[model samples]
Target: MGEGGKRKSRQEDAPAPPSHRILTADELGLLKVSEVPAGDKWEETAAKQRWGAPDKAQGITRLQVHCPDWSSDRCLVAAARTSGRVTLHAGSDGGDLGSFRAAPPASTSGRSDTSTNAVQALRFARPEGSQQLLIATATLGGHVSVHRCPVEAALSTALAGRVVQTWEEAARLQTIGDLQAMDVSSSGRYVAVGGEGHQLKVWDLEAAGGAAAAAAAGADGSTPKAGEPLFAGKAGKPSRSGLQDLAHVTALAFVPGQDDKQVLVGTAKHKLWLYDTRAGRKPQAELVWGEGRITTLQPQPDGSRIWVGNGRGHVEALDLRAAPAKLSMGHALKGVAGSIRALALHPSEPLIASVSLDRHLRVHHAIKRGSLAKLYLKQALTGVAWLPPLPPAPADGAREEEEEEEEEEQARAAAEEADGDAEEEEEQQQHNGRGARGKGKHAGRGKADGGSKPPAKKQDSKRRKQ
Candidate 1:
């Protein structure tokens, strides 16, 4: 090759040094594009991964929050898995405190498919004035077990994140069919179990301890066992009017009414049935929603409304004002994409948390009526329960009263201000009338006295001031 041809090849291969380069430090916003995740891999790359990834844990089937002390948001979260394991976590930070293998009830000792009877329902119920928490779990094979777990003791296991709880059983209500759904009242007085048969078996938990004085004996004549029913009676029955073939009670919620008599039940036939335990077992009213089978029911804190989640990935609020009710799907939550598996309300904050088949946990603001905090856990969460909002701390009572007084004082001040404005308006009208009369008199005087001096200096001063 000739020297000229070789030099041209070398020039082409050599990197250019004449290109323009930055003379000053780059601004942060100038590199925004470099920080953005690829559109196709949105979830794979994002900034708001505060709770971290679900990869840190296994499939989270169910989760319930237990706040024993109402004054603090610090609470223990209990999560159950289809693998026959129940884990306790810190609700504030989602930190694992411990995980324990759930012991199958004595009757199911021989079965290998114990996992089939995984945690179907999990709730934390605190009896009135009780410091301890009652963790109720329902499984596939009709085993309903309750354990009395102390919050401090359970949370201390955070050091050994997988240690088991040694708490004894509080109550166990077993039935004949698969325990499909159940609910414990906020007052922790009644435990209603529903799956098969005409009505749900309602048990009085206060008398579950073999105490005959507190628990009246059952009419069925079954001798009460320890942590068993003091009295067991059917609490809900299928309505005769419209819902054809009431298949199964999918979910239950004891509405926090003026009394503990009303309970809401969801049926397989796309209906929300309200049963009054005080009345006969038949549903008092039925709301035929859409075609999707109702899967979960959550009541508002005030008991004025209920949030219903169905199998078709829809969530709506049902107003419980009238009988023979019909729920119109009005507030369908936005950005929800799969069958909703669970719904939970923040105990204190006005937020609603929901889990779905889409493997996402969404926390929504109740008033704003939109999804606020959302996280993808990559787990099919079946159920979620928030620890009831803490009662006002004793120290806060005085502050609350002061706030009420301040509000009352402000309202009274506003009323007084309105009155002052009304008086001022009346006085101004009177002054305007007097000025008009004076002007008329002055004009008549000017007509009589010929081409008058600009109405007295007083009128001029008043007019200038006005």
Candidate 2:
């Protein structure tokens, strides 16, 4: 490429996202935050009957959804409360399904009850194989517990009518918390939890097998012996993460890939650290984004970029391709008066969902670098997650044979259609179809070159008249 061509290529590499909202709710159901129920009924229940009545804590703090299978269109959303309650709401329109909680340790002598504990973190992950769903819960200054969700039965009960499912602990970990942050890896093999503590611990799911399950059956819960983890922030390591004073690990994520060797961590000191678990304990790369502290970490669906939310209410994109990563871009969440709470990216779409202390849910249209829709939910929005497509229902009854043939035909047709569209998009990108800068001798030869007229024409005409 020539000098001009190189310059143009660089410009095209990161063409600023268009500054307008080009997509709408009608285009994608996930982008339809405006239609999301205000959760007023939930708020009312909380106020009148739930924690709001007793002033135990606050309202919902985290939201997570799951589509049992990715081929179906609907999902189940579970919202966790700061006062230690997790409620399930199923379907596109948030309808109450069931409420669940960890069975209090046996033989408490009525000493400690549900009201005394608060749910610190909540997440839903599907473990591989026989297990359909796993509900991971952490409580402040307490151990972490996992519950096996009987999804189909729960859904059946919800369909039959409003119902509740009391969850029994499937597994237990003795790690105590004010466990401020928690994340499960893409492979579901690991759960990382850290916060308000000196060490960031990564627990192996496989390790939670026999002993952990046996312990879950005991009273008062079994704490892991010696309380060691796969990895911990230890002193004499290669990174500054070791605490001489007090430090908190505010954000954590497993870097996107099947190998899953790398994890990205953010600290209260405005630093982003990348660590390779396969390698030793030291951080591989650390880049600082000077806002306040780093609060949320979102790795792009593609591993090329990591989007970060900071305590200063600004979101910045970090280019991981660089040797030492550099901030490529930054923008503030719309209507945010306080720090950004969470960022959830669509599984396959170019959109991001964000919630803030300002009590708004904003869906960012990535193609535009602007919000597609902002809805005022009027609640303290803390965390959010995107639910993938649900699994397809099994074919049955007399028409099963005919339906299988039709399904095959439809699948073939959809594949071809997708291929054609992909080709068209590639060509469009290649040609720079719209608003291209005309080059060479024809650069200014257009219908209206408004600013290209000879500079002295008017002066010459005046002199001629004189």
TM-score of each: 0.60, 0.62
RMSD of each: 26.4, 28.6
1-466: candidate 1 lDDT, tens digit per residue: 9755654555455432211100000111000000112232223322221332343234445566656463223556676666555666554444556565543533355656554456677777776777676777766666656677665566553333434566556655444366678788887767777775534556776665444322234565332343534323343334576444644778788887646678888877777777776667577776778787788888887887889988887888878755335434457677676777888776666666677777566666677777654555433455545432222233344455567669989999999999999999999999999999999999998787864555676689999999
C-alpha RMSD (angstroms) for model 2: 28.6
- In model 1, pairs of residues that clash are 70-390, 347-389
* True lDDT of residue 423, candidate 1: 95
| Residue 49, candidate 2: C-alpha displacement in angstroms | 20
lDDT (10s digit) by residue, model 2, range 267-298: 78777777777767766676667768888888
Which residue ranges in model 1 land beyond 4 Å of their true spot?
1-59, 68-73, 92-111, 151-165, 196-199, 211-243, 321-329, 373-377, 383-466
Spell out the clash pairs found in candidate 2: 69-390, 69-391, 70-389, 70-390, 70-391, 71-390, 71-391, 72-390, 72-391, 141-177
* Index of the highest-TM-score prediction: 2
The residue-level lDDT of candidate 2 at 417 comes to 99
